[model samples]
Target: MNTIVDFQQFNNATLEQVRTRFEEEFGVMTYFMNPAPRPCFNKICMSELHQSQTSLEKMQGEVIANGKVSQANYLVLASDIPGIFNLGGDLSVFGDLIRAKARDHLLAYAKLCVNNVWTFYNMQAPVTTISLVQGQAMGGGFEAALAAHIMVAEKSALMGLPEVLFNLFPGMGALSFLSRKIGMPAAEKMVRSGKIYTGEELYQLGVVDVLAEDGQGQYALNNWIKKNHRSLNSFQAINRAKQRVNPLTIEELYDITEIWVDAALRLDERNLKVMERLVRAQNSKVNSDVAHIQEKQSA
Candidate 1:
């Protein structure tokens, strides 16, 4: 289904209005949205379908708003759909732009959203941003999730950076976030393989914090909020210090994207076959090991 996302509407909202609107929308008073405010932190939820220019802009505004609201509480940044979080830069937008030879404009728009998330990640808000995943969070969807300090996934959630499948790479800071959180080896596996994860596996890999069963997710989040509320100053201090000590840089992300894009452009059916073979080989090895252990027990 083609969801019409409106960005312009979101971009036009004043900082204070955005804050109040979000609070009213989510029934959470402790949080608000103020992207421009430096020390803003509070409880909010940033989510959208990201279908059009307006949609993307709205999500961006929501993130900025969350930054403004970051005070003593955390925000939940999620998409409307439980199954498909974000499919990435609107292919429709790119396909039309590319056909019309508006490549530069397309690139500029894409970069704008990417950079906005980068700013969100580095915001000085005492906000503990969490990504709530329900369905398929692929490409930029996965990238946006990575921007948060934590990820909460429903058991049915599927996550991956599948930009390679489209002959592109993660233009956002997804590669950087993945590398920092999961290390280069695992991150490379995720990108090069295009293998997605269930919430269970993601939790095991430390990508998601809570493996919630539908409605229970909010309670888990509330529990997290309660635990963090008393130590807001300390929580912010530790996070800020950690960022200062080992922050993900834009240059590093650019370099990673370039490498992945190069690989993506070269990817074809032949490479997919090779990747499948590698996966089969790895799975076979694992099964063999499991069978051997079973045999020893039986003996």
Candidate 2:
């Protein structure tokens, strides 16, 4: 997972070749580039660290570079992880940093996260950004999805900000983005509720842009792109206008992170224990998934 794969190498490859490259890059967390059916490219996330924010920072740079040379019409973010788009921020890292009172380290990580999310939120290039969520997208995962210009989720996919359970809130860009997507009141309720929602529910709530049948997320995404192709310019312009009117600046995100850091530091032993339990739950889910994959391969 530490090794960075050069995405440009497969830029001109055939669909099958791109698929092979994607599989080869698969590790604990990785991203692979694939040419979309349309005049665009896709960046698929296959990671354990909830979009692997560090790697995302690296990938985002490459994306910008590529866009400069050959502008992509769209930038789709999809997950290779089955039944789980992402679980969210690395709680284990948070717990350790909080226990050590490493405010600088926490802030650095938070900033890295914000940088990645902000890039998606702003669509660093002229391309339209899309998040295709096929499964569960929790906490920071949900925040990442919201960062996209369009969020396409499968009907059965689960999405939520469960940070409240650990006495924390999704401070990266959830509040700002969610408030923009859904009203501030609903956004506040979602952040404070600690409840998981189905894609259909989120779609109805205006949090999810498109809802597809189970296992049809990619299809839905492509359909949306095709349907909106003629109006892409106008759509993007409107989005930019929206941003101009109600900006979510990096400064705002950083300010919120400071508050998050302060809040994280205030967690009592009981709260820490609750976080520990969630960490265990995350690990257990991953382990079980690995086991299931191994069993299938053996069969």
Candidate 3:
């Protein structure tokens, strides 16, 4: 566990240069090769909203290329945050854009998000994508998790799309991915309910692929990978077949996003007030996480 994989020698200088390594407690490391035939772990540290999205897009490009050239069999998307996978869209930016009536800018952001999700959903490369959710994944965060070919979540983790609470919807592929996973009716119910479900609940609802015990997410991921390694080709083929049967097109997502932008623009003062409150909640969560890390370090 103490040893780090030296990626520079692999001639992937770009990845080596841009890859980030978080503190040990966060358990975040990106694009590190595992033992023979094991998938590479690509840690995604979701701290800032725009920065995280940009980073994820870049990671996706690298991963797609890496899989093609290096033949990396698996790619796991995980977080560096201890108790929060991602809080979702940048509410602060949303608030500003909405207030300023910047429809084009908002649409651009949504498109960027969809581009990343579309890439993951299609798995353009010959690699299987997995999402390891050890904590809360809300709104766009939940959509990101759903984009993966497989979702492995810890029992204590929570996932939900709370956009409806702020008088909006998760437009960046949430409806598309969730509907495909659990059917349209069920997906619509969950989105409108705005309720957060534990990993166990989602698993029972057939949304979560693997449910692991708390603090054992990494172990569970490794175990699942090992178990599926021999049948990887079959597993990947099944994923492809699933997509073919229920195709999720980029055009569909873009159309939904346009609706989302229009809805956002029409939000009344009360709705914006609620969104502002949610922004405060997100900031509070970030502060709490910082305090937790500080407490742990001081201990």
Winner by TM-score: 3
Candidate 1 C-alpha error for residue 193, in Å: 0.8
Selected candidate, larger lDDT, 1 vs 2? 2
Q: Estimate each model's TM-score.
A: 0.64, 0.80, 0.81
Superior candidate under TM-score, 1 versus 2: 2
Mind sharing the TM-score for model 3? Answer: 0.81
- The most accurate candidate by lDDT is 3
For each of the candidates, give the backbone clash count.
22, 0, 0
The C-alpha local distance difference test score for the whole of candidate 1 amounts to 0.54
Q: Write the residue-wise lDDT of candidate 3 on 27-144 in tens digits.
A: 2233321111111112222212224334434444232232232234565667656677666777777888999999998888877777667766775656677788888888887888
**Which is the better candidate, 1 or 3, if ranked by TM-score?**
3
Candidate 3: clashing pairs of residues:
none
- Return model 2's CA RMSD, one decimal: 8.0
lDDT of 2 by residue, 1-299 (tens): 12333443434322321221111111111232222221111122212122333333344323323123223456556665678776777777788889999999888888777776787787554557778888888887788789988899999999999889888898889989999988799999999999999999999999899999998987787688778878877998998999998888989998998999999999888898998898788777767877899999999
Global lDDT scores for all candidate models: 0.54, 0.70, 0.70
